[model samples]
Target: MHKNAFAIHGDIVWSKNPKELQTVEGGYLIVVDGISKGVYPQIPAEYQGITVVDRTGMLVIPGMSDIHVHAPQYGFRGLGMDLELLDWLNTHTFPEESKYANPEYAWRAYQIFSDDLLHSATTRAVVFGTMHVDATMTLMGKLETTGLKTMVGKVNMDRNSPDYLCEKDAATALEDTKKWLDEVEDSHFENTKPILTPRFTPTCSDELMEGLGKLRAERDLPLQSHLSENLSEIDWVKGLCPWSTCYGQTYEHFGQLAGDQPVIMAHCNWCPDNEVEILKENNVFVAHCPQSNAQLSSGIAPIRHYMDLGMNVGIGTDVAGGATLSMFRAMADAVAVSKLRWRLVDQNLAALSTEEAFYLATVGGGKVFGKVGSFDEGYEVDALVLDDSQIKTPLELTLAERLERYVYLAEEGGRIVEKYVAGRRVL
Candidate 1:
């Protein structure tokens, strides 16, 4: 018998692809050494005697992923919904992030964030930290103890930010970022690493972007940042990078878009045809932060168009702007906003279905972390055992129907009976 082998019996469900949702009622998922072997209706004879973790009436699905979020903003979520992107940043976000310079405050706040995330359905994330190196490291430390896989960025913004929050200059910002990366290397966190983060074109100068680009090449790390999330923000980027054709072009000029390494840009709500082409060409991961866009009055992202264009797409709980960290909420918001976009903005494109949104929440976002968020053979064993008995209706529900309801109605904590990442139970 394989020491690492185990079996989970439940009503299994997972994405075969973006357009297909596979389900097996009364099935068994075979896992060995943190990798999925397959799902079967009957346990194979070879593994018949292995220990079976029974979840007979529960729903077993792939654990969700959060492609983009800000750790510093977790404390202020649901507070600054009235203001748009720029004003909200100055009024609420900048002030809150500046507090992270105090390591004690960072540890306290990040502990809450980490605890909540551990209890939530998100098993993998690409997270953002403020410019303060010690504070960012503090956040990573808290997350490391949670047994979750994450890439945390120590943000860089040398211009167009508050004096208290901004770095002294491009050189200082680059130096600090390098220092943070070195510390992360030394920390030897098993499931956490550093990502390159230039706040955005408005805040990051050309010199800073250039320096960060070099660091990205040298370290071979992934990058994450904002794109055309709002009209005013797009205009701001245009003013900042006058030589570029579009907002994404500025990042492209600095080799920040996906090519050799993965790049995830949050909230491409206003990307024009040219920018879309550039993003598609570079294979950038477009993080659809629908709830954040609505909360800040940013325009709805053309997610349907992006899907049709065959771009890599995922969901994000943009934290303070989004008001929640539930990828379930993010998935629901993605579907709701796409309906509005299809009905009002452009009738030519169709709205996203519940299964499609589930795909975005799982497989699409999982792509960034490499073969995660699915139960396909040889995929990592990131599984969620959900007891949705409370949400179930009197009428019989198929696994697909139950999953859709879980996406919109199911709360975390109690509903999540067992959460596993890489075959090890975390919650």
Candidate 2:
């Protein structure tokens, strides 16, 4: 009766080794319904009764993940590209975030982010919502419908932000986050879940961080926030916590780092040696937003070095700060920025190749949810079906090469024809 079995016939790429890419050609990935059983060169005789979905001639890879992103900033992407990190956040981002006070206004904004997510090659993500509880709830409800596996947060920021955007006190901020959790506790999305979001150390008080930390232990949920993304931000973090050794250490001291929490911190552009050790030691996932860093004039992150050091790193759109939703663009930008960084400052062959960059955008980030990011055996089948029909009619290329072209050559909307999250059709 084959209760749970399907045959996925395609060129399957997945990881048996975490670092080295494994590609199986002319293969049929025999999935036990949702979970992959094994990939064979041909459909085996015993599993012939299973439903066979022919993805032959299509490049089947794991659905990409955006581990760090700000959903509220979708409306303002590419607007303030000329500004640096702090200025961009203050002049454009903070004001846009404050607009979410109206849940109606929030839905109008979040719909754009949601629609874009399904449209792109990414199928799983960790998203950030603004502090407005009702608005954040509306955003969550909307994102849940997309069928993407996501962790969303109601952001907490008590001080150093504008009066319109900032909270009056830590207690109120903590209460608001709890209220958010309570409301969404019964929300029915297979993938959408809530996590604690303190905007950053500069805006969060000691009390707020501690309370959230306590809640983290209680719920055993994943955590997401900004880390040493910029020089000014790192210095601001230092000013906030004089006792701490580095930016990441402050979070560690607050018990936010190095646990089973599945913590995701965006941007490691300026992570010092001590900070790197802390992040690596505690098993922190770095949401490497290369384009946002360059657009905001934040220094290029040492991505190759981080990979060499065996740090858990992945790509993020970061939306308005990043100036794009397309992780494909992020992939290209990561490569471009690394080259610039290597030429201008650090010298060496430290640039990220297209292969490496796309790998991070997909598999590296997917590990946060589980064994996602690839289409081998016994893995969740989150996938983005790319259509290069209009873009590449004449070019004869390899599957991986076509994938690279899909990232650089095609515009945002056309390439990702359909999206699948955990073997369920989303597009």
Candidate 3:
């Protein structure tokens, strides 16, 4: 290997495309200066003296990305599953998020959440924080130490929220957001960045949205927010913004669709064809939360359709809306939900396959971070070393088959043996 390069050997697998899986047994994955050199069957003679870490029995795959997760909501995951979207938020989400106003509470809750995330397979995420600036800073501070690259947004909601959680006004929301951005800038966090979050159309007033859109333009910041995730939510957006043609149009009207930076919209389950076109035209990234959609009884997203349209798509845990932080669960759930959508909702679309789901969890989601989620020479070396030996099988399995089993069956305990972000080991 080169002077500064290191290599790790394993059963390697990564995505070449949404439908393609690239696997290599006994592969040598070379990393130099926190970037992947290449995966080779043998260490080349030109690079003979570098260190090699032997991860012989493990499977190396790209680190998963969760493009949309609520960091504050992580404290209450797996609770309030019986309620639908609006009711669930009212009963559980708003109340839980409101607790973050206390800096101590934010620290305590975020510590646990950050620790769990560090241990999980996700190496990068776009996270949502509560409206409290100090609490959001607290959250980002904890996440920064985990060596995972993340974008955390302090939520902006000036209307249609509980008194405790909503911002006082659009001006206050904008000012607070600017302050948060300024604080984040001053801190100079290595791995954590700030994102503009507008909550959603129902919660953000026209003025708040407009201000946020302008902030996005001026600062050239990325944004994350909910889209047409539920039918009731869509209707609420319709009534909230009568001048807008569709739910997506309301965001477009206020210039929240896309600016200098890309936008990440969670759960485009109910996006109409026009809205779909708008998302495509604007180059918006969709964060598909399959478990959250099923848990909250929101309609399933046409992810296959999005893929067919060449839209940027990624998977998300969605925290409390989704019950787990495991991207493996998200990958499996994506395929399962797509099967339901194919058989019951729309017969014309093909169900997602294992390869497609894996791609969404990896490279597709990594698009937001730029050149991540794969080991395709020069891609950032964020990866996971999976120990799936606990998964017993009677017959021989292909690398793809083993990955499929791990995606569906691996649980929280001891599945990932090691984790790396930018070729630096984090776990």
Each model's lDDT comes to 0.92, 0.82, 0.92
With a 3 Å backbone cut-off (N, CA, C), the pairs that clash in candidate 2 are 36-378, 62-373, 258-282
Runs of candidate 3 with Cα error greater than 4 angstroms are 1-3, 412-414
**Candidate 1: regions farther than 4 A off:** 412-414
Across 124-240, the per-residue lDDT of candidate 2 in tens digits comes to 889999999998888788888888889999998998999999998989988888888889886755679987888889989898888888888887878989988888898898888
The digit string of per-residue lDDT tens for model 1 on 1-427 reads 8779999999999998788899999999999999999999999988878889999999999998898999999998999799998999999999999999998899899999999999999999999999999999999999999999999999999999998999999999999998998999899999888899999989999999998888888889899999999999998888888899999999989877745778999999989899999999988999999999999999899898999999999999999899999988999999999999988999998999989999999889988998888998999989999998887468888899888888988773339999999888999
Residue 300 accuracy (lDDT) in model 2: 85
RMSD of 1: 1.2
lDDT per residue for candidate 3 within 43-80, as digits (tens), equals: 97876878988999789999999998998898889999
Worst 10 residues of 1 by lDDT: 405-414
Q: What lDDT would candidate 2 get against the real structure? A: 0.82
List TM-score per model, in order. 0.98, 0.95, 0.98
Instruction: TM-score winner between 2 and 3, please give it.
Output: 3
Q: Model 2, stretches more than 4 Å misplaced?
A: 15-20, 393-395, 412-414
Where does the lowest 10-residue lDDT sum fall in candidate 3?
408-417
Q: For every candidate structure, what is the RMSD over all alpha carbons to the true structure, in angstroms?
A: 1.2, 1.9, 1.1
